[model samples]
Target: MSDPIPSADPLDDLRALIRGAPGPDRGAVAAARARDAELTKPAGSLGRLEEIVEWLAAWQGRTPPAIHHPLVAVFAANHGVAERGVSAYPASVTKQMVANFAAGGAAINQICIAEDISLKVFELALDVPTPDITVADAFDRTGFVATVAFGMEAISGGIDLLCLGEMGIANTTVAAAVHYALYGGSAEDWVGRGTGVDDEGLARKRAAVEAAVARLDGERDGLEVLRHVGGREIAAMAGAILAARHQRIPVIVDGYVTTAAAAALHAIDPHAIDHCLFSHLSVEPGHRRVLERLGVKPLLDLGLRLGEGTGAALAAGIVKSAVRIHAGMATFSSAGVSERGVH
Candidate 1:
C-alpha cells in the first residue's frame, strides 16, 4: 500500500495564528500597573506574582489577559534501555502509569480536572503502548537529523499551550547518555538516582548511559544522539516543543528528561526558547544542569521528581493565577484609587 500523505505542518499553521493574534496594548499595561499600585496593599507587595500578571497581559496583547482553551499534552513511552537493568522501576510501570493516567488515577489527571484544563496524551513508540498516543508521521531513522525531524513533526498541532512529560522506565539513562554525547562528560556527570534507584542501581544506570554513548561515537548532533540514546517519548517531546514554537504557543516543560528533550529542540531552533516556560525545578541531579544550560528559571522549586507532567501541572495553577490577575484586577482609574506608588 502507498504511504499516506502527511498533514499540513502544524508549525506553519501556528505561525499564521500568531501573526493574526493581537499584540499586548501598552495602554492596558499602564492602567493595570497603576491599578496594581492601589490594590489595597503596599506597592509591589505581591512581588513577582503581580509582575507575572502584568506580563500575562502583555503576552496576550491586552490590558486584561485571558487564556482560553489551555492545553496540557503529556507524552508517554518506554525506553529500550530498560532491559539493561538500569532503572529501579520495571518497564511495566510505563504501561501501568499510562493506564492510571487514562483512568484518572495519575496526579496529572486529577490536577487537570481540578484546574479545568484540557489534557491530551500521546504515546510514542519508545516502549509502552497506549491507544490514545498518536504515532509520529515519519518512520524512525537511524541517524540524528532524521530521528529528530521525525519526532518534531509528530505533534505539531495548534495547541494553545503545551506541557511536556515522559513515562519510560530507564529513560533517564537515555537522557544522561544524550547529555554525555553532547557535552563530552562522563556518565557520572549526568547520571542520577532515578525513581529511587539504589546506589548499585544508579551505578548500573550510569554504566548504561556510558555504554550507549560509546556505542554511538562521532554522532554529535541532537538527532543522532536522539536516535541512538534518546527515548521515544523524549524525541516526541522535542518535536512537540518545536511545533509549539512554530505555533507560538507557550510550552511548559517538566523535569530532567523533558528538559533534555527541550535542549535538543533548542539546539535545532534557538527561537523555540521564546515560546517556552520552565515549569519547575526537579530534584533530579541533572535537571538543574539542563535548566542552567537552557538559561531558564523555573516558576517553582518544590523538590518534585515525578515525571508525568506533575510539576508542570502544579505550575499551571501559577499560570492561571497570572491570567486571572491580569484580566480580573481593576485599574486605578476604574476603581477611583490614587496611583500613589508611581515610580
Candidate 2:
C-alpha cells in the first residue's frame, strides 16, 4: 500500500505558540482529584458534569482548569449553492457576520468575552469569488497546510484549550452536501432550516443539496467531494481540527455545519476524532444525525441552532467543570474513608 497521507508535526509549532509550557500533566490530575474528594461532598455528588471537569483537569494536566490563554477560532466563507437560495439569509450575510464577529457583536463574541477567551478569525474561500475571497483563497495546498499547521500549533501553546466556530451564509447547505457525499444519506437527512429558513426556503435548500449530490455521484473521495460542494470555512475547520490533534489540544465543535466539516475530516483521517469534543446538539435536523454518526454525546442540549462556535463556547464551561472534578475530587483511599459496600 502507498504511504499514508502525512500531516505536519505540531509539537515544534506548539512550543512557539505556548512559549514552551509543557503539555498536560497526568500527576496534576491525581492531586486535584484528591483535593476534590476532601471538599465534604459525597463522592461524585456533582454528577457527570463534575466528571467532565475532572477530565478537563487531566487533559490540561493541571489541578485547576485554567483559561489564561483560551482561544476561539472562527472561520468564514461563502457557498456557491447559496446563489440558489438555500438559506433564509442572503449570501452577503456570511461576510457581514464575519464583520459582526470582528466587531464583537455576535452571540459567540459575547460568550467568549464572558468566558474570557481570546478569539481569532480566518477566512477561507470555498466558493464565493469576491476580491476579498480571492485574497483569502490565495493560499495553495502547501500554504493552506502550513497556515493550519501554524494556527493549531500556536493556539496550543499555553492555551488551555480550543473551540471552533464557523460563519458562512448557505454554509449549512454546503455542510449537508458534504454529509450526503460522505455518509450516503439522503439530503433530507442532512438539510435543515438554516438561519430560520421558511418552508419554501427549506425545500429549495434540500433540492440544492440533492442536486449537488446527484451531480457528484460516483465520486467518493473526501477532498474531491469537498471541492465539489464544500465551503472554504468547512475546509479550514477541518484543517484546524487536524492541527489540534497533532498538537494534542482538545477541540470543542459547534453545531451542524461544523459537525459536517468534521465528518468529512474524519473520513479523511479517523484519528482526528480523538481530540474532538462535541459541544451541543443543534436543533438543526442534520446536527444530531452527524453527532450520532460520530458517536459523541454533546455536553449540552439547549435547542441551539446558531453557528459561530456559540454552542461550543457555552459548553466550554461544562468542560472546565468536568476537568475540575476530575483533577479535584478525592479518591476513596485519599479521603481516609473505609469502603462500606465490600463483603
By lDDT, who's the top model here?
2
Tell me how candidate 1 scores on lDDT.
Answer: 0.67
Candidates in order: C-alpha RMSD to true structure: 6.4, 6.3
TM-score top scorer: 1
The CA lDDT at 230 in model 2 is 66
The RMSD (Cα, Å) of candidate 2 is 6.3
**Once superposed on the true structure, which residue ranges of model 1 sit more than 4 Å away at CA?**
1-44, 50-63, 126-158, 341-343
Clashes of 2: 24
lDDT of 2 at 166: 86
Measured by TM-score, how close is model 2 to the native structure? 0.78
lDDT of 1 at 194: 80
Q: After superposing candidate 2 on the true structure, give the runs of residues whose Cα lies further than 4 Å from its correct spot.
A: 1-40, 54-66, 125-157, 325-343
